[model samples]
Target: MATRRDPITWFDALNVVLLTMVAAACVIPMIHVTALSFSSEGAILSGRVSLLPVGFQLQGYRTVLESAAMMRALGFTVYLTILGTSVNVMITALGAYPLAKPDLVGRRLIWLLILFTMFFSGGLIPIFMVVRALGLLDTVWALILPGMIATFNLILMKTYFSGIPTSLAESARMDGASEIGILMRIILPLSTPIIATLTLFYGVGHWNQFFLALIYIQDPDKYTLQLRLQQLITDGIGYGPTVVFGQADDIPVESVKAGAIMFATAPVLIAFPFLQRHFVKGALIGSLKE
Candidate 1:
């Protein structure tokens, strides 16, 4: 006999409709922006573009790509994201591994101290002073060192590590495996889900880094993508040799803005697909207790 399925409830139907609407709400704007970026000047000015590009052209992208300053910022942001995310994941994993052990001295106190940072922190001026005092100003370290270990990600990692069976670690210990060896061989190997999740989180954070770069970096050459994008949108700054004199007038300002936004956002969107399989599973598992 075939198994009978239960009929869908009204509540389930309502939830599906609501979630679909919410997803559409989030996606439609991106579609519009993309369309705007690709649409021709005439179509953009006439407001003829919506979900799809009308009279499609690559002028906006060509203008963005041609700019030296924008290219530098893109390169810098890419480097920062890769380096910063590596540091974040490694540091968080190392820190979480120790805290996951039940016998660690002052574990509770140490956790409390770390937890305190979540609720409170030295304000912006204090943080700026600390950064300055450390002589990290105008350097990439200014951006990386201060926010290396995100508190929430650390907590997630620690929780996930705790859920790993102690029997594995015990067996390793019996085999004369050092704590570091155990972590490297056993704990880390099993913690892929959380690691991947935290990697995505930290990667996104570093990719979007802007305010810190603005505050700490005085040199325009060191400016990040978001910062440069801001200048493009607000100051109406012309980019590249092509934009000089009357050439910039040929490119519509709105299209350039849309294009710039899409360019800055594209990397993260491209990266998400690779990590999405691990992301939800990691987040849910890490958040729950065994």
Candidate 2:
């Protein structure tokens, strides 16, 4: 039987107040940015806009969307996110499944070696040289391949896979199911929560890839959205050089920057909800034992 709970105490009230403030701290900046994006040039420049738009306008969004470079960057980012996330999920799952098997020989050494990578790397120069040697420079593969299998995600996946009942795997083997068959038909079906969670993780990582593109991709056409936005922010003073008006001096750089941020951020925010239902469960289960 369930026990009766005591009524909320002063401590509970204090906790609520503290949590609400923290929530506001996070959400308020986004609200301000959204409001700034819609606010008129004069209102933004005058520093009058706050949580709400003053003298609403769509100029910042219009400028960002109208640029051919921005459009190309958006398209490239979408492609990179989709392709990179797919590769990450596939490779991580494949690698993790084998590692999760208790009977697998030399698993500890393999795990240790992989874990070592998380703490140390050969540095940027060596990585760049390797990418250059592979002829991946200035290519989409340059963005997707270098850091494909994140060690953290791999560890999480292996932990998740290990939690599945060993009996289920044994039963499949007894029924003559191949290892691949067991993974595809048995393990994966039971692994939806972790899969969805990791997909979201990988998707967001690829969507936000900037430094990789900045280093390896020289062609303007291959610039990811974040990298292009950085260029716009630096070169255009946030508002493009061509933004025409008598009140041109009144235009706020913050508004243009916010609009660009929103443009780059929208897809991830939208994609998040589909995977959110599984995120908490996945994180808890994966982290608890390993």
Candidate 3:
């Protein structure tokens, strides 16, 4: 027997139309930027480029790639992302696991204290002073250590861990498994979805890290990719003076900026696909309470 389906209403149609417009608003600019990046200087300057390149060329990318400063910034950003995300996930998980245990003494008080930090903080100057006092200024640790365990990510992880059946942990404990052993061998393996979700969250944060780097890192050589892109866009600094001087005709300032934007954005776009399958499920599950 065929079941009768509800007929589409005006609200449903309106929602579809609005969502499509929103999606296009987000996507069209990216397409235009990509087109600008690939199009010839003449095409871009004449406004001939839109969603598609008018005269395809790779000179902009070539200029960006040939620069030593941009390459160093890219390497440093990659290193920061990897190291920061690893520490973030590990520390968040370890903290969440213990809090998830119902038998843990003072769990509620500990949770309340942690939760208090979300609404209140020591402000920028105090944090900067503490970092400076600790001799973390002008060092990578200044960026990583200050904002290590995000309160929101920790809460979400704890909620996810709480949703897991207690029987699993009990079974591991009966076999004389330690807390660390249970977390590593049983809980973490089963929490892959949330782990992957948080990994993406923390990874993107680290990748797009700019203000922190700007504040802590005074050395131009240690600039992150975003900072380098900012320099390119604002100062018309095309990689270096030599590249700019030689390729000025082939790669215009606007084209270089577009290419640099794409370069900074590409890694996150590439990595998101691998984690997309788990992202929605993990986010939804973690946000739910038992």
TM-scores of all predicted structures: 0.89, 0.90, 0.91
Which lDDT tens digits does candidate 3 get at residues 1-290? Answer: 22458676797889889999999999899899999999888889888898998789888888789877889889998899999999999999999999999989999899999989999989999999999999988777887999899988898888889888999999999999999999999999989888998999899998999899988898876888887777677654555433333445544677777898898899877887898987788777755653
* Sort by TM-score, top down from the best: 3, 2, 1
Residue-wise C-alpha lDDT for candidate 1, range 4-107, written one tens digit per residue = 58666797789889999999999999999999999988888887999999988888888888877789888988898889989999989899999999999999
Q: lDDT score, residue 70, model 2? A: 81
Instruction: Show pairs that collide, candidate 3.
Output: none
Model 3: residues >4 Å from true position, as ranges?
Answer: 1-5, 9-14, 235-251
User: Candidate 2: where are CA atoms >4 Å away?
Assistant: 1-8, 234-254
Clashing pairs in 1: none
- Per-candidate Cα RMSD to the true structure, in Å, reads 3.6, 3.5, 3.2
lDDT (10s digit) by residue, model 2, range 1-290: 22358676797789889999999998898889899899987888888999999998888888777677788889999899888999989889999999999979999899899989989999999999999999999999998888889888888888989889999989999999999999999999998888998898888888888899989988888889888777756655534433322133544556767788888888877877777877877778756864
Best lDDT goes to which candidate? 1
Which candidate's TM-score is highest? 3
Model 3 TM-score, 2 decimals: 0.91
lDDT, model 1 = 0.86
